[model samples]
Target: MDWEPHARRLADTVLRRRESRWWNVLASTPRHVFVPAWWEHGTSGPVARNGPDDPAAWLKTAYQDTTLITRMGTRHADHTTPGTLLPSGPWPTSSSTLPTLLVTMYRHAMLGPDSHTLVTTGTGYGTALACRRLRDPSLVTSIDIDPYLVTAATERLDAIGLHPRTAACDITTNLPGEFDRIVSTVSVRPLPASWLHGLRPGGRLVTTIAGTGLLLVADKADDGTANGYITADQASFMRTRHGDDYDTASPPPSVWDAADGDGDTVTTSRYPLLDVQNTWDIRSMLELQAPGIEHRFHRSTDGPRTAWMAHPDGSWARAAAPDRRTSPLVHQGGPRRLWDTLETIRDRLNRTGQLPVHGAQATITPDGQTTLRRGRWSATL
Candidate 1:
């Protein structure tokens, strides 16, 4: 069976809704060469998919707009057994990001003919795409913190006769090279100062903020600062890992279990229960008001809906109702009223008829301080 025609069809279908700026690269690149095995989040946890064991399935999944989890926690799919157990949830340490999101970041970066690019390499499929577009391994530098990942990606890129500058290093620390465009598939909290220092004047950077699905786009100015606006479209990726696992964002057992318990201030919710993460504006605003808050949602077969929102700052809120159309009974506890803050932000958005976060401006100072401002609200992350 010829896979090239299938790859071309996949690219045509996936790029139908977006600009066809990268159809050629996706159509020609062989995804299975980069991602041989991956995992899927199951009801209990993640289950591994051995690509070589099923070539047809691998070809189909590789071209879809889905994230292939190449590494779970510390266990790479290449090294995992059928009974290997991870300590926690199927947290993806590294993977090939969704193709749509990858293209979105690249589109936002707006690379030019003379632009030198810096990108993060996970499975290296993205680096392959970049090399295809930029047409030079010399103009692209891709890095990952895990030496194993870097080595594997280097080997895979070479297998396809495409070689870019691949390195193992912490992206937040000293970068590998100067770049006209810095695009990261992994998320970071505050914009890294090193990125600003490494970006040539008038260069652009596109990346997602950790803990929220906010895409940050900025351009370096002559004053040694980078400033840009948030895009309305949302995209998120795994947070940059240092050693192996990500820092736990799960709330304490007490706070998580008693999320619906009484609080310092309790009242009816201004709006119905919502999956904040699904909304770019609401999630971004809540993340700003209460940093590092964990959110969850559940519903019975034919009963009420429950939304649990918790923060590491000892705050949690539960909104419950028989139907989502009706207002939810809310319970909150902590020094800070997280639900109230979310409601306030939502109310402000309702009044203003738009989210400030949608087009909020971001500024990164020379020393690495990052700030987001819209109207009178400004937050330094």
Candidate 2:
């Protein structure tokens, strides 16, 4: 069955419910061709999905407007045999980001006909779209830290009658070349100085901050600096890696389990129990306030809301609510009160009636010193 039409419809809805200039490119390009096989997120672990074995299901997943897990830990789906039971512990190392999110990032760049863009390479699906949009593959240069990914993506692009400059390099350490627009699907901690050096004056950069949904869309200035604001659209991406996997291993339950107990301060919270992962505004604020706080949530069989948060600094919080009508029982431990900080933020939001992060001013210096200021409060990236 032809899946191009189905893919096009999904792409339109993702691009603000309007017909995008890149619509035709998205329509014609066959995404399944690039990702013949992939890993699907399964309850037990990463499950392998084969293309030739189940062509129909493959088309359905390939055309869907969702991310397809392509790698788990350092094991790639392409390398895994079909129907194999893969270990689930390691976090997803790579994926073909939902087509919609790719459209959003492209739109954020506000690309011009003659624009030259430096982009990140994952499955090369986004790279293909960029090539199709510009109609000149040479105008686009893509990079990935994995040599295998770079080689496979290049070969796949060639198979589809499209070719662009692709490289295997650590983007944070050094960029491939100067470009008018620098867009990264991977998240970074502090804005990389190498990125600023690679972006031409009067150009734009769109990316997310590591551990947060904050999207930094900035443009280069004549004075060797870049400034912009956080987009209201909260976006998340895997942190950039210098090697096959993330440098910092996932935290064990022991680090956070200690915080789930009766804490130094045990009291009723003013608000209902909330899962930070589900709340964009408050989640982004908390991540900005305290970066690297792992968030999680659980529900009892009878339906009590329970939320937990833990950080590397030994800060942890747990909140539980018996029902919607009752306030949440709060517990916090460690050097900082995790729940209390969240409540303070929620309190500020209650009194101030707004989140300053949306459309807040963002400034990045040449040396990569970045800051975000909104009203009286300010924070460094």
Candidate 3:
């Protein structure tokens, strides 16, 4: 598919100067073999990005490091072979994650040569990298909720003379074995106690705590409570889905009402093109502290930009400004000013050059409240 040149550039640009362990894994693995076909979201629905009807543009996207929506709205794109095109659907059910972020999460996973690793497999790209780095099938067990995905991953990994124990298992429930490291590409709202139960003492676990945050890395403790730090990066994968996949959560009626308010404050922000989704320090901290909020940003072709933040708890914020450089006019209602919280965090980062997400102390309680403390600021997610 002529993807090697692009893959090599990605390795040099993204992985170069990163942790050697993660860099080696990213450079060694062949990504294209694992994702032969994928799905893309369109205005009307989810469309196949492979096969005879698929355009060269579609193939380029499918092979890139970017996430490709492979299924949505009652259809699975992976089942579409090399000569058929499936219509695009409403939401993304699955995807191959960004290559850079995948490596970033792995860097935090702290997997060593001898470490037994448990990873959630999707397109099997990540699992392939794990196999290449660990080079020991018995030390790595990759699981996925879909049996078809597991079977496909097994075959693909085998093609490269790499094999790991593959299983169609739900990670939110019991895992198959105790391991030295556990990393999940899927997001879960609460930290699973089964993860803690499956780890040997002093083992490490890296995952995105469902509902609000970034990658969390911690070592298993003697008392059963693990302690570690949040990574200085942020990413969101599709939420773990069961049965017929994720049903939309009930919306809070008061959010729309709050968006229609005039009592909220209006001001310009210092940063333009917030790119909150791309900010490692800010996003990781926010996810850990307030994972319930979903973010939305809109920029018109003419340049008027508006951003919104909504929480399931009836809290919401909307900010609009004429240009990226102008301070946003913010309207917030319910419990707090969401943008204000973010700006406060930005100001902290401005003063310190970075938030303390990387070195912060994390204490996982028996109830799944992860408390992170850095200097005078402390938060629970």
How does candidate 3 score on lDDT?
0.73
lDDT of 2 by residue, 206-245 (tens): 9998877888899999998999999988789999887878
Clashes of each: 1, 0, 14
- The predictions' CA RMSDs to the true structure, in order, are 2.1, 1.8, 4.1
Ranking by TM-score: 2, 1, 3
TM-score of each: 0.94, 0.95, 0.80
Per TM-score, the best of the predicted structures is: 2
Which of the two, 1 or 3, has more lDDT? 1
If both were scored by TM-score, which would come out higher, candidate 1 or candidate 2?
Answer: 2
Model 1 misplaced regions, further than 4 Å: 17-21, 82-90
Off by over 4 Å in 3: 1-14, 17-28, 41-46, 51-63, 80-89, 211-213, 250-278, 287-289, 301-303, 334-354
| Alpha carbon lDDT at 66, candidate 2 | 90
Between 2 and 3, whose TM-score is larger?
Answer: 2
